[model samples]
Target: MGVRLNGRTAIVTGASRGLGRAIALALAAQGAAVAVAARTERVWNDKLPGTIGDTVADIEAAGGRAVAIRADLTDRDDLPRLVEQARAAFGPVTLLVNNAAFTAPGRPPRPGATRAAAGPPTTAAPRADWPPFVGTPVHAFRRHFEIAVFAAYELMQLVVPDMIDAGGGAIVNISSVASRIPGAGPYRDFSGGVLPGYGGSKAALEHLTESAAYELQRRNIAVNALSPSQAMLTPGLSYYRTDFDDVGSEEDFAEAVVRLALVDPQTVTGRTIGHRQVLDGSFDPFGP
Candidate 1:
């Protein structure tokens, strides 16, 4: 009834703010004991707001169970410890929302580039899109993949075994529409901002999700990648565009993830479902 998670436990990465925070709260409200993990535990800078502690307090205040775990997603070594801590706080994680990602704005573009780069290159603006693909540093691009793909893989390895033993579980890899837009079909003119580094990373994550889903289905574990059917106007992105046209809300995403996380593993494994599709009970991602 209404996707109850009563005895389940969940780990929401990047729960410090934005989508992660919203998803964590949603899970807890649905009766899941949530573990909020993020590097930001307290306010050190005014640029970004929200923290694991804040998320936990919000969850607890609403009469739900949650714990905060401070972790840096870039550091692969910290994942096991993070998972261990979550397990200790609640139990084996039944749901893992891999939403943590790194995308720093206003960084100097590649050498020899100047005003030609995308976004405000030298603005004091609170939010700006990433530099052009050619201008992005290799290391910087690698970090996006590290957090979105590699970090997620490491965490999956840790929780998967336990998930199998406990019967079944779900893994939701939070991705972006940037991963697939302006493609080879009739929808080729769509321009929802382009940053190859972040986009490539998300594409790889979706591939990993499909492959993992195929292999893990026998174990009763489902892996799916989800992206907002439309652009999301989060606070970070809002600084650039205040208009909410054709954008989905954070609550929409959180609710979709909740439904996906609670679905039957075998029936829903290996999909790259969108927010609207999940809400509409459209399991066939390729259906017209």
Candidate 2:
């Protein structure tokens, strides 16, 4: 057994399915109680079942504690209730995964081939959310910002105080390759009110992670950004299936998040790390 997160609790936002479900399961496998939150409720019994319900059931079956929380992170008020449920069911959340995200219409469906791009963790070259600055619209930009930026920011504020009070904790924000690097290849605009904002907000979220990591470091809390190659094959990706091109999958992305949450809080802080590099152990999974 690893001392990594034994007896601790973790809250993963957007954990109903896809990468979020994978991370939640991974954390539970390692002995931490998990709080799973998402806007969509997981139907325990459905004709075509989803992973969210399965993840929760798996955790309980394995003798680990887990709770399902219905939270719309974009609505800031929901955060308090989410936190309270986690506390009531498990304990203080020693780990947090900022994994929920949003995208606009027509944003080139994510990059990669056969999920090759989402492999083993390393940095993915960032893509530029285009129409190049001139054609970008304010509403599209704002919509992306709401989920990609503010949602993460607000959730952290709602929970970090409790983490600090308990000594230290870990916060891993799921960032994007689009924000890490810059425009590559031909750029196409996402949809109305969701394009430019998605790119800008992700970039901004990385900045926010750094600032918070610095401020929270002394208290033993670890804060960092983790990005997959392109976007994972999320439910949101159903609309852009052709765009995936085998770059990433929810499982590969989920494992990366698990690797991050397992790190010692005090040791991993103030940096951005990619799944490709960290999963292999040539470098620390969570950069300091």
Candidate 3:
């Protein structure tokens, strides 16, 4: 109903469930033909609800156009194919929501939790000892960068031409508060500290967002990184963190994403901001 993307196509990665699913649904509701991309095609885990098929079904049931794209973002080959599938199913991609990310290894496990109790096997690594960042594996950093930074950059490269030909577009990169680097110590004993690999990758992504936005602004493409102002208990987060009390809602977060998707590139680009910032009228997309 908003932004009037009736003829536009959108690609949303990690859309099988959680925040990504919410975002895809919001985009579809706003009239974009959405391509829901994720690894889950079937219900592999009952604990992790929803799949690309389920997302597509939900969209169709609501009378909006959508396609299920089963893609593993870690697979480089899947990137181009995912874009092509969306383009073929609808039209040139004018919108992208890079919502997929590798769940990093951290989070103090709930007491008496086993390896199986640590949510999806694929997404989460085995529970590490307290002070998890110690001796963190190189592969963990690689995986985080592969999905959160490299894949996003590649997808942006693949879609810019389509957007250029169409005159304009928008890209919203889902980031996290974890990306925030802690200041000088005297730091409190935070139980849920973010691991370096995950936080580092997101920090890199924010840089990518700004760099891309600067280059693409003249071409009428807006690129921005968005994070929740506070923790939200989505399915993924609920599995790792149960300490959040005053949390944000998925609907509000999705609406913020929709707003970013609809931005006028010339006026608003390169913002590394929060959902509450977008909603509360404090986000100056043009500001430093």
- TM-scores, all models, native as reference: 0.86, 0.75, 0.89
lDDT of 2 by residue, 1-288 (tens): 234568888898877766777778778777788998875453322221354456688778877768888777667778889888998888777788988776413221122323233222222222334345566677656767777678788878878887888888889998776673446535466442233455577788889998998898888888888877555656444433435555666666666777776566567766677777556666653434
Q: On a 0 to 100 scale, what is the lDDT of residue 4 in model 2?
A: 51
Q: Where does candidate 3 clash, by residue pair?
A: none
Task: Output the number of the TM-score-best candidate.
Answer: 3
Give the whole-model CA lDDT for all candidates, comma-separated.
0.80, 0.69, 0.83
Candidate 1: global Cα-lDDT? 0.80
lDDT, residue 265, model 1? 69
Q: Encode model 3's per-residue lDDT on 153-207: one tens digit a residue.
A: 9999999999999999999999997788554577786755655777889899999
| Model 1, TM vs. native | 0.86
Model 3 lowest lDDT segment of ten = 104-113
Give residue 128's error in model 1 in angstroms. 5.1
Ranking by TM-score: 3, 1, 2
